[model samples]
Target: MSNLPPLNNETIWDIINDKIDDAMVNQLVWDCLGYSYDNSSQQWDINNVASEWREEYPEPPNFIENRPPTVKLTRSIPPENKQLLKEELGFKGYKVGEFGPRQTRRATVANWLLSYMKQKRETSDR
Candidate 1:
């Protein structure tokens, strides 16, 4: 059983605010709210959703027009690499057939590796 709290309008707004900058916050807030509404009610109501969002968050930040991505990269881990990663990380109880949970653990391990590498480089440079 997941311990995550149920996501509501305010929680969605707070999540957006935390993950995104002010310029993108309003757009994401509306996007998440609109999606949640449509997902629950099976209907679209962008205008009403926007209105409600505006009422909740008065003086919303200015919308930023889409800009070209600064950089792009593609990455994929092969099965052999995943096996190596599992062995290297000493991951436990992760079944081979499950992708989602394994992928999450792989990402966590990758991040830890990167942080360790960075610290090692910094120490060696000193």
Candidate 2:
């Protein structure tokens, strides 16, 4: 016996119509599962989800004319690297002054620089 709730034809159609009606839900469903309404086929299909969505909505229309530009800084090192650096450098909570040894600080800086350089090199090679 399945534990799923009963969904009749009407209920299913209602849900589909609701999704089609709401742009936000439509976009979300498209992004999450790449599901979108098909006008030509006259039925919903996921033949080429990504391509179909892209073709339908080429790009998000400039709804906000003068919206603030988004700025994203990609960190070379992962969060775990930062956490490890803090732990290895002995950064204590409530400590006001320089904590770890100068050598440890130097080593951390060197390691970060090396990793950054390596990432750059790999990207450039590709």
Candidate 3:
């Protein structure tokens, strides 16, 4: 159990979104799901409460799926310059083409490159 005070569903969600470390939030999620942390699997064991909680509160939408494929970087950086930046950032081929789940820092750079590519296609159509 976490040292933090008991949090309702909304408060748990708020804490999850805030600056707290992800590992801590993961434990909180397990608490909410009524699961006990398992050291071996590095995961929680789903208990009876989890199934009932799911009936009450459906899972939140996946962040990457919910977000736009590209951030709005095009409004600031022109497509040509962005291409040079993308090359410098070293996101090529499949990495450049897909906006998949990745480490936060790398994902931010990838999103910027994707934004530029998106704008290039948009401008080319005109």
Flag regions of model 1 displaced more than 4 Å.
1-99
**What are the per-residue Cα lDDT tens digits for candidate 3 across 1-126?**
657444443333333234444344434434533556567987545543445444533432122322321132223345555554335444343435443343332333334434444565688999
Error of 2 at 31 (Å): 38
TM-score each candidate: 0.23, 0.24, 0.28
Write the candidate numbers in order of decreasing lDDT.
3, 1, 2
Highest TM-score, which number? 3
Kindly list the per-residue Cα lDDT of model 1 for residues 27-101, writing each as its tens digit. Answer: 343343342234576544455444644454343322322111101000222333444324643435335675553
Our tally of clashes for model 3 stands at 0
2 against 3, candidate with superior lDDT: 3
Residue 41 miss distance in model 1 (angstroms): 64
> How does candidate 3 fare on TM-score?
0.28
Instruction: Count clashing residue pairs per candidate.
Output: 0, 0, 0
Q: Weakest 10 consecutive residues, lDDT, candidate 2? A: 65-74
